[model samples]
Target: MITPKASPAVFAVGSLTVDVKGTIGGTYLDLTSYTATASSVSFNPLGGYDFSFRENDGLSSKRTLSISLRNLLIPSPPDYSESVVTERGIFVYEYDMKSSSTIAVTQPNPNLYRYAFNDFKLSGKARHTDDTREITCNGFFLLQELTWPL
Candidate 1:
């Protein structure tokens, strides 16, 4: 007799939240989608003819964040500008598919993952007549972390 094979578990994004506090202050609850591009690392090879002999420059390129939100039917566009170094900037949160619910499983299941970004600035913006807006933010997030809930 042959046993049946089991399918792998599925992963998905459950929720997203973006909070901007600086020259502009608002909590974007209507997040349609968002994308955070990875930052580039800077390094140099210390020894010749050996790729393994490398030293980190202790620097990384800035991260690019693109966000789409549902139009809130406002009269004017919100201001997101810099004026003499504003206080706390933007913050983004992403939760896994298991964040909203609990599951009962016989085996060990992976805990949900969370990603948070801080110190972002508005780099670009766009508005569409179709009731949607896209904004881009650039930031040098020195503290980027992914961790599970306690």
Candidate 2:
């Protein structure tokens, strides 16, 4: 019998809520803020994927904050295929402090202090069918996690 190699670990799925506040840099940056909820179990694999390189807690975007998610780990080893797939769901918006109305995931033009979504919501039963699918559980599920940059 062959067992599908599992990830090193799995983060239990749950509801999450977060609120972010910050101040801009040299020019008095205060144009960024975020409120989020932890991804819960959904029919889709990306129920609660939320990770970003923006300011988690700071007076400026000069510094960034992030965390790693287990789902980001590819179950297939390097020996096999090297396919890059979406592991989770992430929602990010950018605002030009002065122009609070303009919200976007990224700046119209790239800048030194810009950021983007490196991850998305991964929900239950995700990637459960890469090449195999036979769970003892009544139902299988996938969970996308948020990972931070080093």
Candidate 3:
């Protein structure tokens, strides 16, 4: 849930128009199911996360942006358990084999636990004294499952 954009607009804070929304909660282990909220709540987002998005300033735009992104995957039959990094803005999560730090999924890789989320994340921080583009991240997703014995 990390989104950055820059479309048809002057840069340098001029002709500005920002729309940012974020939210994230931890404790996952979908183990397949593609996480679509049939129950078992706990930071639901259909059940899937992966956060980080901070780009778009233009420096002083002249109108030129071709940004586009879309990635979502979460569905398992069983095998997904991660529980660290507590929370991120709210995009993708599932990696807490104990603790190490390095989210996005990495333990075997085969849809480890499975994911399925889209809650919009990465918010600007700074107490909002005015607005300066804060930026935040920590939405990891690592649902695993892989076996080879031939």
lDDT of 2 by residue, 1-150 (tens): 966555322233322222222322323223323332232222224432233232233232222222223233321110111122244533222221121121112223322112222222211111333221111101112343333333
Tens digit of lDDT per residue, candidate 1, span 16-36?
222332212233333322332
**Candidate 3 backbone overlaps, count:** 25
Candidate with better lDDT, 1 vs 2: 2
Candidate 2, after superposition: displacement of residue 57 in Å?
A: 18
What TM-score would each prediction reach against the true structure? 0.19, 0.20, 0.17
Any residue pairs clashing in model 1, and if so which?
none
Model 3 misplacement above 4 A = 1-51, 56-111, 119-125, 128-150
Alpha carbon lDDT of each predicted model: 0.23, 0.24, 0.23
For each of the candidates, the C-alpha root-mean-square deviation to the true structure, in angstroms, is 18.9, 21.0, 20.2
The clash count of every prediction, one per candidate, is 0, 29, 25
Q: Residue 87 deviation, candidate 2, in Å?
A: 28
In candidate 3, what residue range of length 10 has the lowest lDDT sum? 9-18
Candidate 1: RMSD over Cα atoms?
Answer: 18.9
Q: Report the lDDT of model 1 for residue 149.
A: 33
Tell me, by TM-score, which candidate is best: 2
What alpha-carbon RMSD in Å does predicted model 3 have with respect to the real structure? 20.2
Which of the numbered candidates is closest to the native, going by highest lDDT?
2
Model 2: what TM-score? 0.20
